[model samples]
Target: MSFFSVKGLSKHFGGLVANNSIDLDVEKGEIRGVIGPNGAGKTTFFNVVSGFYTPTSGTVEFKGKVISGLHSSKIAKLGAVRTFQRAALFPEFTVLENVIIARHLNADTSLLNAIFRHNTKAEAGNLARSKEIIEFLGLKDEQDNLALNLSHGHQRVLGVAMALATEPELLMLDEPVAGMNSSEKAVMVGLIKKIRDTWGITVLLVEHDMKTVMSLCDKITVLDFGEKLAEGLPEEIINNDKVIEAYLGADDIVA
Candidate 1:
């Protein structure tokens, strides 16, 4: 069985059907890209996987266990995490502190233990682990800076770092490189590969940058009007006539 699977997934609001019986499978350590124009329900799909929205119908299985309808915190504890398009870091907090807080999700220390001063070991461990995460995300030099003080690219990096601190087996990123400059985009591309190569984590990315998606993703799923239009490797997707028509108004090939 695939490490993660979504079968017959669906969601609806009033008379609007946002998602209709979508089936997606993500194997371990694969970088999958989901692309579409506005209102394609790509983000909505991510929300469903991340526990932001409970699917109206269908099942989501992770690690051979069903996770559909679980609370967000419950789902997160199952090792699935997501980063939003907008940075969710606390602007007033230092960059290092922001990531440290994220790492708290997995901390073994308990509030009661802290009250009895029995969490010294756990506390020390967290400090060391958070430091490692800071360095891993390339924020070692900016650790002391406030989150908002960092450049836009750095802020996005920090968000990814924070999500990594969750130690998720499946990581979903929403437009991680949106609004970044060419240099920043390059850095993000490298970071994505590094995360997958170094940590063996599965990644699900929703992005509009076709070049980046094609280069980074092992598999691509295309959506239009909340429906799946195509699914294949980057090369096949790029060459498919139906895929081209979905993106390029009308074909000028015959004209």
Candidate 2:
């Protein structure tokens, strides 16, 4: 089995079918990008696979375990975590604090451990790991700053840092570089590459920026009108006529 995959997955909101039997297979340590036009069901697919939404049919498998309909927290505990289009963090918390809090997934919550303070070692380890994540994401300089005090780009990076703190085997990102300037996008692009190469983490992202998607992904999947439109290497996808016509107008083909 691949590291992460969704087979015949579909999601429906009332009578509206957001995702219609979409199938995606992502190998371990690969950076996969999902792109589509507005209402292509890209976000719905991400939500269903990440456990934010339940599939109307089919299944989501991670590490060969069927995880469809699992709670989001349980799914995260199983080593798959995802980020949202907007930065998700505690606004009043310092960057370090926010990340440290996210490490709770790995923390000991047993009553005995808590009452006896036997989790001291665990807490210390979480702190060190959180700091490592902060530095790895280049948020070390702003570790002491409140999350809301950081710039938009930094906030987005902080969200990534929080996700990394979970030590996931599969990291799902939704529009990771959304609302960023060119330099910020470049930084995020490099950071994502390092996240995969250095950490050996598998990445599955849905993004709108064709350039970022082309540059970062090992494979690209295209969706249109709630169904799979195309799937191939970045080069293949860019040149695919169906993809060009569906995702971007033929006249405005992606370079």
lDDT, candidates in the order shown: 0.85, 0.88
Sliding window of 10 residues with minimal summed lDDT for model 2: 108-117
Q: Give the TM-score of candidate 1.
A: 0.92
The backbone clash count of each candidate, in order, is 0, 0
Candidate 1 Cα RMSD after full superposition onto the native fold (Å): 3.8
List TM-score per model, in order: 0.92, 0.93
Evaluated with lDDT, which candidate comes out highest? 2
Q: For this target, which candidate reaches the highest TM-score against the unseen true structure? A: 2
Candidate 2 runs further than 4 Å off? 109-119, 250-255
- Per-residue lDDT over 121-220 for candidate 2, one digit per residue giving the tens place of the 0 to 100 score: 7666767888889998888899999999999999999988988888899999999888899999999999999999999999999998889998999999
Model 1, residue 150: C-alpha shift (Å): 0.6
Name model 1 segments beyond 4 Å from true: 106-119, 248-255
Candidate 1 lDDT over 1-255, as tens digits, reads 989999999888777888888888999999999987767798899989888999999999999999999987788779989999898998998887787778876555563443343557886676677788788778899999999899999999999999988788999999999888989888998999989999999999999887789779999988777778899999998888877777634332111
